[model samples]
Target: MGADEKAQNKAEKLGGKVQEGLGKATGDREMEAEGQKDQSKANLKDAGENIKDAFKK
Candidate 1:
């Protein structure tokens, strides 16, 4: 909902994507799982923000 929060979430998601790609390229299952977890966390944060914004309205 906020610009800063949005930016942080986007950055986190992007970082996760990069990490995921790196893991895939190198065949690291642990790293790939971590990256996926990061992405899921970022998504959850974004969803929470959206819910808060909706309540604000």
Candidate 2:
């Protein structure tokens, strides 16, 4: 929920997007799947932070 966590989550999401793009370009299905999973995990963490922040208000 803190700034560091948010930054890390954002970085991870960006990395996942890059990975997915690279995988698709190279025709690597496994890599694409992994990237999607990473993106999902990052999104879930972001959602959790948002929920905590909302409760704090």
Best by lDDT: 1
Query: For candidate 2, which ten residues in a row score worst on lDDT?
Result: 29-38
TM-score of each: 0.96, 0.92
**Alpha-carbon lDDT of model 1:** 0.94
**Candidate 1 local Cα displacement, residue 29, angstroms:** 0.6
| Candidate 1: segments with Cα more than 4 A from true spot | none
lDDT per residue as tens, model 2, 1-57: 899998999999999999999899999999898889899999999999999999999
Where model 2 places Cα greater than 4 Å from the true spot, the runs are none
Q: Each candidate's lDDT (Cα)?
A: 0.94, 0.93
RMSD of each: 0.5, 0.8
Q: What does candidate 1's lDDT look like per residue over 4-57, in tens digits?
A: 999999999999998998899999988888889999999999999999999999
